[model samples]
Target chain A: MIKLNSNLMIHQYFCLMIRYLKKQNFWFVFTPYFWLVLFFFIPLALIFKISISVSEWGMPPYRDLFSLSEEGFKIDSTLSNYLFIFSDPFYIRSYLNSLSLAFTSTILCLVIGYPIAFYVAKSHANIRIILLVLLIIPFWTSFLLRVYAWKVLLQGSGIINSILIHLGFITEPISMLHNHYAVILGVVYTYLPFMILPLYGYLVKFDLNLIDAANDLGAKPVNTFLKVILPLSLPGIIAGSMLVFIPVVGEFVIPEMLGGSDKLYFGKIIWDEFFVNRDWPVASALAMSGIVILVFPIVIFQLMYAKYNFKNE
Target chain B: MQNTILRMNKLFFKIFTLTIGFSFLYFPILTLIAYSFNDNKRVMVWKGFSFRWYKELFQNEQILEAFYTSIKIASLSATFATIMGVMIGFSLTRISKIPARPFFIFLSSSPLVMPEIILGLSLLLFFISSNHIIGFPSSKGQLTVLISHITFSVAFVAVIIQSRLSSYDKNIEEAAQDLGTIPNMIFWKITAPVILPSIISGWLLAFTLSLDDLVVASFTTGPGANTLPIVVFSKVRLGLSPEVNALSAIIMLIVVLAAISVYFINRSHIKK
Candidate 1:
């Protein structure tokens, strides 16, 4: 009787172990993939399928857009939609405009963000915390409201103009609103925090001894900064640029609000195509083109970054 | 003469950097806050001071409803995203035998690099297809919005938790197991305590992302369900008002206070 009972106990123990292993296996294998499929992969696949498939309704209104033929006929393939975007001067210009704006804003962000990051990194603990909070506080407001405020300030009869006119600085308002400069300013303003935080992360762990060594070696301050600080901080610059550039490429609201009706941007164009024109195909084509243009450079940068160690500084 | 020139250059650089940084970061925000108190219904004109706009904003039923909806979606999505994040983090860190760990990591991080518009459009298409075939998610509404938020928010949470886990010591868990503790008990009693702070921080971060989101919400939100950012965007597109400014100021205040409180709390704990 004792032997039988011990045998049964061993069997139960084996069963329990198997159950535990199964649970672990399920969690490790099944669960992550399940969520990824449901959330990520499926959605991406759906987008591709939607963009490619022929519209059941007669040439969904978006298809007729940018057509030189004027027949309003829809083509089911990806090439024609892409061709339309590429062939059109308006679309091509918008892409170039977005690129320039993103590049400029990123450079502006780097110029503005680096010192603040350096200061915060070198500051006393209490001051650092306070400065960090100050940096983040502006982010809490709706981005839309902030853009609108810029509109008020930059408008013809706006506060900025009123002040300038009262002071006799200029005879008229500077035509700040609804201009390319306003769009760039808005983009730079909105994305500055993104630039600062990454730079701050890199700067925080930066070694001060290198700068001291460079100075002791008789390098001028500018030379020291150029030779020592800049190269050492390249990772932060790259990361910050990526952060600012990627989002700015797809930004719609800022340009729409501040750029006014006349200014054309890829984001505004895509928004118009998708929502107003109901042209999913062309919008998808534009979106896909954007992804293609960005992905290649990003991959190249990543490869280069991985090949070299900028973290040693 | 050389020393004076160097000093002047340094001073100029310092002033220039500070001016540029502050103007870029703070001007728009300060302008909005200032305009909120301008007492003028016209955004372009500064009349006087009055709290009437704030009163009007509070009374606007649409704004209030949108605010509540945003809070609800943010809370729910943040909670679920944190859970998924923790799970993914645990899988990546704990399960060494798991194949393709790097692939999973890449897959998770890919969303972070993708543009918001693409993500939004893709998710919308996904929902429409899934609804047609599966017959589940019978209608799109809060459920769709929350699901979409969680999809992106989880990646952020996972990134945070994974970094935290990488830095955590493993000996504590090993010691617990050697003391005849079961895996479940060891996880609950030891791993959970060590990682709880990260989990909380991840949740808070996810919540903030969900709250601040505009683009994704625009794509996923169904008819009659508007988030706060969307409402604010539409209103501002029409015209800016002090009420919008007041609303923004209140949000800014809350976020600042909460962040400071968290910082102090964390610092005190470290001191202890």
Candidate 2:
């Protein structure tokens, strides 16, 4: 019995030593792994399960969310939800509309943001600080409130029309509100800061010596900017594009408020499916499709970005 | 002479860009501010200057309720998010030997990249399932809203704290440990002080994000759980109102003041 007790004691000491070694070398690594599993991985796994099981379990009030049948069934899986999305003219049109709006707004933001970022970076130190503050002040306001405010200004009886009529720029109030133009304008306004900040981050680190060298080599100012500055700023452009484009694709509020009933976007369609129609399966399917489409481009961009250390360049 | 012309052309381009850009950025906000003071029954028509709309905004009960709700949620969510973020940040930085660190980083940031509507929908579905299977999350209300806010806000806080932590020196904590200080004590005394600025900024960011969010709030909120953004959104959908303008102006004013204070505080701290 004494020998057995001593053997147990020896085993306990060996375990303690192992634990201490792990604490010294592996604690940092293990703790984060545990946290990621607990908080992020588990929740995402649950999301995937819910998406897959909606048809099987009859969750979310309505059943067979993925199929045309109202009755919940386990007989077969159908791609009707996805097929319907593509075949339906309304859904296809909304998708196209949203894509175009996001594209145009992204381009507009780039055009407007790049030069301002350039100027702010090149300006004197105090002026740069002041300009940056000016840029950020508008951002501090509630983004929703800002969008709502834009709605007021664009409405027929709103401030813009009133000012235009008073100034004799138009004899009659133009129907500016609740249209494609308003949606594009709101998107560009909201995302402009996103574009500018990344560009500014890039431009601040840009070497002026490159431009000076190009000029000394007898390159014209336009050519120097196109050759030296633009190439260097490509990373910022890509980052800014992702930042703006990704969210704009799923934007519901700006389109809902400004695009009026005349236009429909993908976000509104998804909202309608879930809330108004109570079709959870179809909504989940739509969301999954959007994820699939968006992830492809993002993955490609990230691969290219990694291949070239674009930010550092 | 050629250089002078080239310089003039560049200057012209700069001015043109600045004018167009600033006008687009500032016009709507400026219009909102100006119209709030206009003394007219109709929102668009300007009669004269008045503070009537501001008074009306204060008098509205629903609007006041919304303001209170938004403030409460923002404060609660920011606090919770900051605590979780600090833990995650500590784990990522100090606990370096963990397997799959890059994957963890990607997972945490994935929420940020995902569209808000999708995140909201997925969370809503998740909560519904949990309520059914586990009998927890009895209903989606203030608690659910707070949890959802924390879920996203924590990621932002984690990113911010991680950035701050990367710049922190590890030797300070090691020295504290060498003196036989407890790990938690070393964290509180040595590490927390160094990262306090980042903690505050993270908290503020989370607060603003919760306050500004509409889509997620829409999905998670039950009846009587209206946030300020939802109240304003529903009202805007009905029609334009001067009270909304007044409310926006007040909100913007508070934000600007807070930002200025933060800027000064940061500057002074840097000087020190």
Candidate 3:
């Protein structure tokens, strides 16, 4: 009788707890909030702290920002890391190169991906889904593998050179493996789907009668594209460009594998600073500035846009 | 006659654009697949067609181990990320009184735009500091990599699940409640069944993101936990290797087949 009474009390307590939790909807918010706070926000705060610390040759490779000196609690910090990154031509030039690389690749992908997306979107509705599937299948395969494929094709004795030589276009195997052009080609090849998919998303929904109506109203093919299609697809173009541009700015793998030593890239420089030079402060400084220069502006823009829409409503 | 000529020109343009665009995408992949069967050790030379590289890949223990490790890590990371994502999505869509809602929104979305290299660096630094102060995660390896993958992957899954939940019909739940079904029972029976497909897709999306990660994995991985991309990257960076080509071809085939099967299943579902 005593054991049964205790069990009944425990069940009642558990039911009460469940009722309280449901009333507040606590589980849904608390679980993800706890994880994001620990892993995401705290890590970002830690990076900010380290970015200001002085570089030292200890095991962890940087002096503590807060320390207990003989006099009392003291803080040791330096701005030389940021200063060095800004004042040095090498670092500034690499940042420029990365920006330009991202710009060129974005344009290249837009020019090439636009037509494919338009045509695929305009294909027979019955086959449109199959075409879309085909497009996405290649994207799902190993990204490293697709880039590696280019390595094989661009090598001096690879298939491109073999075909060129067989056609008697050149007498010797031209060295084509490592260069800026090779890196650009590799980037364009890999990021093409990023461009195409968004364009397709917008284009597939478009009504074909608009094109016909434009033609009937005496708009020429070129004018129709300029006035109708391009303007309508502007959102997709911007979306696709942002997707490609932001990541490509910090691209490491393609540049490392395909680019020659003639030029340095922003990603490579930061990597070299941390691993090769073992300068933790410089690396952290570089990352901090990257967030400021590349990521912060876009975030601000998004917030402004959202506020504007909310106010309008 | 002029109208006929114009019509011919349109047809020609469409066909030409498709051929050129598609050829650019497929030419490199085809060449890579072709060379994987070569008999020669040197990648540049084409001696003959053979299965020598495939045999070599099976014998190599390092690549095989990395592949298995990647599968395990991806599965675990995806599962955890999916659970968290579902909870976040459910909260944001169904509940209106979440505390710190704006902060939660910012936390989930910011990682989408953050660069991979910077994300990788910050997480590694955080792990090191936490280890020094708390004396946990004594060394970075599989666990560290898993944690990093889940952090980034949760953003992607959450976005997908959020869209799915927001678009779903809420009247079904209301109707169930009107029929005198308890709120808890209605959620389990109706809400879960409706969102189950989205949950599955979120899991798969998370799986691929974790599997394909290289930069983040490199930062967090230690002595014993080399991933497939890391192994393949190290080999390919130095130059080409025949075994890697074989591995690429096999993976490509598997992916294409899987994608096709998924397409058919989805088509059948739509028809039904």
Off by over 4 Å in 3: A1-22, A300-313, B1-8, B97-102
Task: Give per-residue CA lDDT, model 1, range A46-144, as digits (tens).
Answer: 555555543334433333222345676545444667778899999999999888888999998888788888877766677777777777766655667
Q: 1 or 3, which is superior by lDDT?
A: 3
lDDT values, one for every candidate: 0.77, 0.79, 0.85
Pairs with steric clashes in candidate 3: none
The candidate scoring highest on DockQ is 2
Evaluation by TM-score, superior candidate among 1 and 3: 3
Output the lDDT of residue B26, model 3. Answer: 83
User: Residue B64 deviation, candidate 1, in Å?
Assistant: 0.1
The whole-model C-alpha lDDT of candidate 1 against the native structure comes to 0.77
**Lowest summed-lDDT stretch of 10 residues in model 2 chain B?**
B96-105
DockQ of each: 0.39, 0.47, 0.45
For model 3, residues A1-313, the per-residue Cα lDDT tens digits are: 9999999988886787577577866766678868877887888888888889998888799999999978999999889889989999999999999889999999999999999999999999767888788788778878888899999998888888888999999989898978999999999999999899988988987888999999999999899999999988876787678778878888899999999987788888878888899888899999888877786545753453234212311
* Candidate 3 global lDDT: 0.85
